[model samples]
Target chain A: MPHITIESGKLTDEQKRTLVERLTAVSSEVMKIPPEFYSITIHEIDDASYGIGGKCIDLVKQEYMEKHS
Target chain B: MPHITIESGKLTDEQKRTLVERLTAVSSEVMKIPPEFYSITIHEIDDASYGIGGKCIDLVKQEYMEKHS
Candidate 1:
């Protein structure tokens, strides 16, 4: 059994509700498993800790400044 | 951007290391995103809180006792 957790940007209650519904539906459709069987948790991390494509975003912005200025 | 968490039964350090490596590799293969870009956390929950298919396992065991006895 795989227990799954999804972390997204700070979400409103509406967004949270919609996401749980969508995730339940899609997970069922894709995995052929009942929605009730899945255990899901959501967490929000600070922006500084999350990065994209191996680049620390703040560092990237700094690089852009040196190159452009 | 999706942050992923995986909860499994208490895993050995070997298992944890292996899982991180495999998850990173497969996520890259399937999603075509760099492994470094994904933030993955692992948690282990108590057995009592998890269930399968709308049935609480403890309740199921209780039912089996009533039926068989």
Candidate 2:
């Protein structure tokens, strides 16, 4: 019984469902548990709410996109 | 930029705050990152919504509590 939680930027409902399905499948395979035995929760966060490398995700994304694009 | 996501049974606001603070402190110590660079998200889940060992958390808790008490 694995409880998987993912926190990241917002995603569509379809994306959320797909993620849950994929995570469940992979976790079940890796852990030798049935997919139905797994619990997955997705938390949609704002870019400003998440931080990385001492900067908020929004800033990081902006910089990265600027550099890459 | 470590994004920490915690999924478990419901916790109080105070508990959530304490958890975030403690996790940030320890993660910063171990990861050599500033506390402000860490992102922590806590998801309060109902026992029924979580599963382990093919059993829902509510059932697991009830059985465990009964056995222990």
Top candidate (lDDT): 2
Report lDDT per candidate: 0.61, 0.75
Model 1 chain B: weakest 10-residue lDDT segment is: B23-32
Model 2 residue runs over 4 Å out of place are A62-69, B1-69
Please provide, for model 2 over B1-69, each residue's C-alpha lDDT reduced to its tens digit, 9 standing for 90 to 100.
677877768675556556666777888999888887788665567889888889998998899999999
lDDT of each residue in A16-42, candidate 2, tens digit only: 989998989988998899888899887
Residue pairs that clash (backbone atoms under 3 angstroms), model 2: none
lDDT of 1 at B68: 100
Per-candidate interface DockQ score = 0.24, 0.14
TM-score, cand. 1 vs. native:
0.45
Q: Candidate 2: lDDT of B64?
A: 94
lDDT of 1 by residue, A16-36 (tens): 665566545544444455767
Error of 2 at A54 (Å): 0.9
Candidate 2 chain A, run of 10 with poorest lDDT: A47-56
